[model samples]
Structures are given as structure tokens and as C-alpha cells.
Target chain A: MDLPFSTPAGPDARSAFEASVMRHLDAAYGLARWLARNEQDAEDVVQEAVLRAYRFFGGFRGGDARVWLLAIVRNTFYTLRAAAPAPSAHDAFDETLHGGEDGAPDPETLLARAADAERLRAALARLPAEYREVLVLREFEECSYKEIAAITQLKIGTVMSRLARARERLARCLLEPAAEASP
Target chain B: MNCEEARVLLHAYLDDELDAAASLAMAQHLAGCAGCTQRYRGHARLQQALRDPALRVSAPAALRARLAARLPAPQPAARAARRWPALAAALAAALALTVTLATWQTLRPRAPAGDALVAEAVSGHVRALLAEHLLDVPSSDQHTVKPWFDGRLDYAPQVKDLVAEGFPLAGGRLDVLDGRRVAALVYRRHRHVINLYQWPAADGETGTRERDGYRVVQWNEDGMHYLAVSDAAAADLDAFVRAFRGASAAGAEPAR
Candidate 1:
């Protein structure tokens, strides 16, 4: 990728770029951690993403550095995922079942019983990559529908529907003791 | 809005994604309707649960340092080239000539300097480990690791599989030393890491030194300066040096 303008070859410009990118390191790593699903893989993704961002720093037109950096992090994760290995069965989640009309248990009781972080994490992990990504971007990252749309390259309507479906699936996974008891 | 309409927009309502009119309608519906309000509360509870601090993971400290160390230094020449498109071609020719001349000059024989280079090598070794930036192109296979340096550096440093010698090849990375880019070949001896820094040698005799409890072994072979730095005992480092030199020598003859 080419930078629109020449980056001045000096410590000042270098540090400016570093500062802009570094501030979003947590956001980048956090998104990567959720997407990649492990610390080592997350580190690898972040490391590569950071380098790519630096290389393309010349092209960065100043705006929300966090969003800009996270976009690179997202792209890097996809690239690494594609190159690394074939997807396992567990990586795939059925979107049709995400819209199941099963009646949820009482919210208060379910919330109290399933408040454990491990259970929530496991449920989140079981989600299909697409649903999981939208959930994390909205619930975890607190990004708006427009921001999620921009990052994931989905329409705003799709972001809303996916997030709605993702939350429902997560709630089912967390609350349904039968699903947990099986395996 | 009725229950069906409210349910469809419940998530948007919970997320505050609705317009002012829609939001007002939803709020009115939630106040009057028990079921929708309960659903909204459930959504809020789920959001709270997901946002728990325990559920979030922070970037590790070493990872942050590793990324910082990997940031490329500013390339002033590239900026200069961009500003003068006409001069870029001429500048590229001059640069090629300068690199060629410098490579030739470095191949000539001279006594190797002590202290400064040793200190630099030792620091590079420590910085790489402490920052967790040990390898940029991590691989045990020489074939995989060697080709990674192509177009990344001016010269390709030899990557030898030393696993048979108890020092296995880890990977390689482009490092800056003495204000010039050099190839750093990484190898692992048990838990210890050895960084072999190589650049076009400036006619220097082989030497060894110890600083900060690390062994620094320096040698020049086939127009490249090889400095191996590690915390491993000097004897093990020496064995590495010998094995590395022998491997490179064996490979160099075929290329020549």
C-alpha cells in the first residue's frame, strides 16, 4: 500500500505515528484476542498488524486512530487465519439457529446463576465468528452500529440483526443447562 | 408501537440506536408493557455480564514492548526521493553505487574493534529477549527462514539448521546496528537465546568478549560480520560459533 504523502524522515514524525498507533494497542489487542481466541495467536496477530499499520502509516489520513488501527488488526487476523490452517467444525456456527424462538428463562434468575465469567466466555467462544465479532464490537468495544458497519464492512441493518441474533444465541448458550450438561 | 413492533426494535432500543421519535415510543411502550420492559432488563443484564472486567483481556506487557521495538526507523531518503521525482532515479543510481563500493570495502581485511560492538551486541541480545521481540520470521527450517530475508535486507544472512548441535535455528529479523540495518539470525540453546548479528564485515579479525554476564563472540567470514551473543557458557557459545562457521563454509563453497 502506498502512502498518499511522503512521511518526513525524522524522529518527530516517527514518534507521532507511534503515539497515534500505540494509544490503541489495548483496543487492537483486545479485538485480536477475542477474534483469535488465544493469547499467543493474539500476540502474533497484533505484532503483524502493528507492523502493517506502520508500513501503511503514510496512507493514514488522521481521524479516530483506534478505529483505524482496529481495522488493520481485523484485516491482519483474517489474513493470518486464512494462511494458518483449515477451519475446524467448531469454528462454524449456524446462523439459522441463532434466530431460534425458544422462550428464555426468567432474566433475573438466569442473570444471577450465569453471571460466572467462565460460562459467559465459553458461550461467547462457541458463537460463529460472524456473530461473535458483531457482539464483541458492539457489547465489548461499545462501538455504534455505524462504527461496526464500517469495521466489519457490513451494512448498518446487518450489524443490528447480527448483534440481536448474537445476544440471543449467547443467552441461550449461557442459560440452557441442558446444552452445558450434555458435554 | 405494539408488542411485535417493540420486540423487533427492542435491541435497537436497548442500544439507543433509535431516532428520537422511535426512542420516545419505545420508552412509552416499556413503561406500559411489562413483557418488553422485562426483555429490555434481560438485555441490559447480559450486556453488563459481558462487560465484566474479568471477561476482558489486556495486552501483555512484553507484547507491548515487542511491538514498540519493531517500529521501523524513519527513512529520510525515501522522503527525499518522494519530494524530487526527477532526482529519484539519479539518487537510486548513486545509492546502488555507494552500496556496492561499501560492500567491497567491507570485505577487505582489518583488525576487529572491541568494546563498542560487543556492548551493542549484548544490548541487542538483551533487548530482544526482554521485549519478547526475539524473532520476526520464526521458523526452524532454514529454507523457510532464509528466504524471508529477501528484499528485506541488502544481503541475505545464512540460516543454518543447528538443531543437531543442541542449538536449533529459531528465526531471523532485520535489526539496526551501528546506524545500519543488519540481519540477526536467532537460535535457541535450551532456554537461552543466541542472536547472531551479521552485516558486511569491515576486514576484522575474529574476537570474543564477555559483558554483563553474556558471551559476545565475533568473527568475519565470506564478507559478513557474525557476532553471536548469549548468556550460555562461553564453551557452548564457542561450539555454536564453530558449528555455524563450518556450516556456512560448507554452504558458501557451493554458491561460489
Candidate 2:
């Protein structure tokens, strides 16, 4: 059964909606940071989301403002991403160059430390934006299969399979480090 | 359940979209397939780890200051609507409030978490039973799965295939437990998913031991702790334990 999500946002509802968005400041910013991959750009996206949310605060149906705010953040991020150059200025760390892990407690003891976080960032920079985009959404955004679907406009199944393959390729990049170290 | 099927259902498995019959099937398969289990756990852990970095960067002072100065004190809905055309929706909502005193709650709807982690395990278990797609990365050769874990994590994880001998290696994945990332190897005998969550120990501490409704053999050795859980007949899981325990003790450390 399809039902409209909007209920009535009375005086109480409006205040509650604002408060609700306030609570999700961290979450919304977190998501923006993941997508933009830079603190500044992420902040820019968050700012845009907040403003848009304020502008349309009236249209908001009174259920789950957090989800609504996040949805807005998702929408706003792509718009900026399309206009923004090199998305890296946003400061999101792509883990490709680090080649995955090394050195923690001790070298061998540290299973998969991002000893190569820097290297990962560089390697990630070299990949096509398509691949980098998926990794950021799946890895950093941690958006659910459905959420990713909504954000990327891809089917849920596509999101999963794409993420799996992307990780596999990323793993390949990371694994080369071991081969380089050996012999 | 075969590896390909498990891969397809991995998302559904995580979302808990399958019904009871199917979930049980996957559980049975993951119980004994090492390859499938590792992929599942790894996907999950990676998802979690990737999000942690975004915890919170305290809105930069510059951004916060800019926001405070530019944004007006949110005008009272009534007053703002008159001054700013942009706040028409806020005005509309306020108007609706006065016209109808009906109580309505909208926003912050609770979610069903049963679809995520624990539910994923059950879904994985069930699908394996109905179909043979339990192992996506099929291999009796520990060499295959062991290598897959090479660049994935620090210590190569042990993925043993003992299904033919009554103790089947289901699959493996990277999982999180005890606040540390670990490997969860799946094994099975009949209709149980034996989740063997393993993580390299910090200083080399074997884990705890206890018998819940299920049989769990958890202990740390060399540098990793293994927690093997199952709903199979206790004795059968014991057989798997004996075989696994023996392998490590006998020095078949394929996970270099």
C-alpha cells in the first residue's frame, strides 16, 4: 500500500523538526565528509543541506526528520560533486594507496593497519571517479543498500555487486605491497 | 548454498529479506564453507571501519561562526512566513496547526535492526540449506582462500574445508568482536552455522570458554582467538573442534 509520508507539522512539529536536524548534525556531516572525501567540501555540502532543509522545512512531512535530513544531504552532495573539481579538496581519505595495512602494536601483530593511508589516498586519486565514488559510498558512507540505491539511483543489487567488485580491485591494489616487500 | 548465490544474497542476507526456510538453508551452508564466510565478514567489517573515520569533526570554527552570524534567529513561524517568502511551508504548517488540533506524530520512526548483523548470519545460514550456493570462493585448497586474505588483513586467516569428513568448511568473512577486527570462519555438519570468529591477539591471549544453548569453542593461541559457534549436535561440532584444534596444534599454519 502506497501512502504519503507527510503528516501535519504544527507549531510543535516545526520546532521538533529543527531539533531533529540539530541532532543529526554529526551524522549528516559524517556522510558529507565520506562523499566529498574532504573536510571543507563535506562542510560545504552539510551547509547546503542545512540551508535547503530550512528553506523547505515547511514541506517536510512529520516523520523521521533524520532520514529526511540525510536524504537532503545525499541530494545536495551530488549536486556539488558535479560542479566541484577534483572532490579531493574536501579532504576525504581514500585508502587505496596505503595498500590496506601495516604496523600496529608491532609489524606482524598489526593485521591490516592503514599504514598506507597516505599511499591509499594517492592510489585512490589515480582511479577513475566511478570506482572511487562507489568505494566512498560503500566504505565511508556506510549507507544501507536501500539508501545507496536511492542516493546513486542504482538498484540495490547493483550497489552490492559493484561494492564487492570495487573492494576486490582495491584489495588487489593493496596486495601488491606484499609482493613488492617479498624477495 | 553456493558461493555465487551467497554473494547475491549477501546484501539481502544482511538486510534479512529472506524468509525462515531460506535463512536456515544458508545457515547450514555457511556452517561448513570457509570461502563464503570470509567474504561476508570482510564486507561487514569494512563497512563498519569505513564509517568510523567520519565520527565527528566538530563543525570547523569558521563554518560555525559563519552559520551563527548569517542565519537569522529562526523567526517565530508566524512572523517569518510574513517577512520571508521562503518560509511559506513553515507558515503553512503553522496555519494547519491552528485550524486542526489533531495530534499527529511524524518523524524519527524506529528501524528494524533485525535485518543487519545477527539477522544476516541467520539469513546466510538459511540460504545455504535450500541451495548449494554456500561457497562463492570454492576451494578445498586452503591455499586459495588463505591467499585471498593476504592483502585483506594482517595475519592470513585459516579457511579449512572439512565438509567431506563430516566437518565441512562453510566460508569466511572479516567481522568485528571484542572491539577488534577479526575473521569469522563458517563450518557445518548438518543444519548449523558454526561461526568461528578469529582475530590475532594483541599480547597472545586465548579467549574465554562457556556452553550456551549452542556449542562454542573459543580459545587464543599463537596470536589469534577462535570462537566457533554452532547449533549442530554438540558431538558433531566437537568433531569439527577436534579437527580444527588439531590442525593449529599440529602446525598446519596455512595462514602465513
Candidate 3:
């Protein structure tokens, strides 16, 4: 539980810090890629995240290093997003087109007809950042609600609701093509 | 529970987040309600599809290598400032204790060279433990731990298996002492971790010192300077030195 930053940074301390952070690189990259929506952007975000994590490593209290690292990645991604230009027209379109709607067909029936991986990725890519992050953490990372709450800094109640909404939106998006084709 | 309540709780149910009683209630509701059960099935399928390992990309090897190569070494000035104050105090106390103890016994006066090295060794040992940098290549096998230092340092340090003597080999790490790289072979004695640092020696000599509640035993063998540091009792470290010397003498290999 030694705060790594408070201890004088030495090569040994740096290596230990590196070992803890490196173990979660893939997971961090995965979250970054999903959030940033591209490999190049993800690479940039993760590299920045690594640097930020190292800078503040001395503050890290020992626990689940993966969760700790992903939280940093999340923060770094948001910082980068804030610095970038405003969301594009397509992003705006995605928001308005797929904004949560009530009285949709049952998600089970909608998802049953959804197509393959590419479509799933497109559907996930279209979700708002908040919803996408929760869904990805839960389904892809296999994080429990508590962990998701910690990583996303959301209350457990918010996490559950966002997850529910994310699923609803994803099911709606995935079912769109099927509905169009049959109608 | 009705369909409306079941729908609200379904995600938590899928995630196994609900408490036992609530989970049981949801299970009971799903059993009786075909609609909620199908919705549950759909949620399960969505989770399964999203879990496609392909969706979670592994960080590319190039990026990993880049980050490893690019990570800044600890700033020397900052490191010195942060590491030395506590050590200087410990060394001062050790010097004081040495002076007091000298008048009471005819024990060999503490070697100045050995005293400085022991302080450095103790600092390295404590830093490794506190920072959780006990090992870079964690292993029990001598061969595995020995080869890990290859190409990373100028000389090969001897590694040995001492599990039979209750000091099991924990692992090895490269440490900087006296402004040069030295091999730190780690061993565990019950709950204590002992750091045995080895570098090329200029002369044949042996000594021991105590600093900040830790004992350090130093020796020279086959042109290698060996300094072992730990918070364990002086008697225990003496036994460790004996076992280490015996093992190294029996299995000494040509230094590379």
C-alpha cells in the first residue's frame, strides 16, 4: 500500500511500476480503442495514458492494478476528447438517430436477427461514449458493476441504468437493418 | 416480481449483480413469464456476442516495445534527494552505534569501505521491498534467474538455490549501487526478504554491518563482491552468508 509517488522514484521503483502498469496494457488499449473509435487514436490515447499513469504513479494505492490503470486510460481519453475539435456531423447524426427511444421492439427479438461482428462493431461504435464505455466494460472486460462503477466513476445505480439503455440502443441499432430489409 | 420489475432488474440479473434474494425472485419471475425469459435469453446472447475476443484487441507488440524503451529512467537528482536523507540518518545512527559498541568489545573495527557499501545495500533492499520491486525476473530456479541478467549487465552474478536451508530463492533484479549496475539476488527467509547484491570485487575481504534495524553481511569470493542485506536477525543473516558461501564454493562456475 505504499504510495508509489511518495517513495522516491528509483529504477527499481520505476520497474515495479512498469510491471504493474504493463500487465494491463492490453485492457487499457482495448478500452481506449473502443472509446477513441480507431486504432491510431487508441494508440495515442494509451501512450498518453501510460505517461500520465507514470507521472502520478506515486499516488497509486495498491489494489487491482488493472482497474487502476483503466481508470487512468478513461481519464486520459476524456482529456484528449475535450481538447479535440467539436464532434463531427456524423457523431451528431448518430446521437439524434439512435437517441434512446421507448416502446421499441423487444431487444431479444431485435437482437435475434442482428448480423455478424462487423455489424455489432458498427452498432457499438454508434453508441454515445457513456453508454459504450459501460457496455464494453461489462461485456467485453467482464467487469462487475462495482468495478465498472469504479472505472467509470459512476454510481452503481447510474451504471445499471446506462447499461440497460446501452443494451436497448444496441439492440435497436442492430435490428435497424433487419427491419429495413423486411419492411 | 412482475414483468416491469423483471425488465428493470434483468441487466443486474445477467451480470449476477443482484443480491441473493432479489436474484432468486428474478429467477422465479423468469420461470413463470415466457416474455421476460426470452428477453433474458436475448440479453445473454448479446453479452456472449460482445465478448468475442476479437473485439478486444491486444496491444500491438511494437507499442509495448516502444513504451518499454521510452519509459524515462528515474531522474537522478530527484532520486538521490528522495533516497539519501533517510539513509544518511540511518548511516549516522549506525556509525554512532559502532562507536559505542567499539569500546565494549575487541570486535574488528567496522571497515569504512564496507560500511558505506552496507548503507547503500540496505537502502536498495528497503527500496525494493517498499516499492514492491523485489524481482524483475521472479523465479526459484537458478538457471532461469541467472540467464535473465544476460546482456543487461556487464558481468554475470552467481545465483543459487537455497530452499533446503529455508532461504528460498525469490528472484533476481538489476540494481544500481555506487553509480554502477549490480546483480541483486533475492531470497526469502520466513517472512523476511534478503537482497544479496553482487558486483566485481577489487580485493579479497569480508565484513558485516547493521543499519536501520537491518543487518548486512559482505564478503569477497572468486573476485565477486557479495553484500547481503535484510531486516532479519544478525544470527539468521550469518547463517545465510554461510549457506551462500558454501553453495557458491561448491558450485562456483567461471565468471562470464
**RMSD, one per candidate, in order:** 14.7, 27.4, 18.4
Candidate 2 at residue B183, lDDT? 56
For model 2, the DockQ equals: 0.07
Q: Could you tell me which residue pairs clash in candidate 3?
A: A4-A58, A5-A58
lDDT (Cα, tens digit) per residue for candidate 3, span B144-198? 8888888656677888878898898988986666556578999877656788999
**TM-score for chain B considered on its own, for each of the candidates:** 0.55, 0.41, 0.55
Q: List the residue pairs that clash in candidate 1.
A: B110-B203
Give the alpha-carbon lDDT of every model: 0.72, 0.52, 0.73
How many collisions between residues are there in candidate 2?
Answer: 73
Instruction: Estimate, for each residue in A1-183, the C-alpha lDDT of model 2 and write its tens digit.
Output: 323234323456445655777667766776676566678667767775775565456566566666677778877777665543344432343434233443111212122533345544544444444455566655554556666666667787677666655555444444444533321
Among incorrect, acceptable, medium and high, the docking class of model 1 is acceptable
DockQ of 3: 0.18
Evaluating just chain A, the predictions reach TM-scores of 0.88, 0.61, 0.83
In what order do the candidates fall by DockQ, top score first? 1, 3, 2
The per-candidate count of clashes, in order, stands at 1, 73, 2
Worst 10 residues of 1 chain B by lDDT: B94-103
Interface RMSD of each: 9.5, 14.1, 13.2
Q: Per-residue lDDT for A1-183 in model 1, tens only?
A: 432234223577579887888888888888999888888778878886776576456557888788888888898788767644466676666656334444544689669855988888888887777888888888878899898888888899888878877887777777767554322
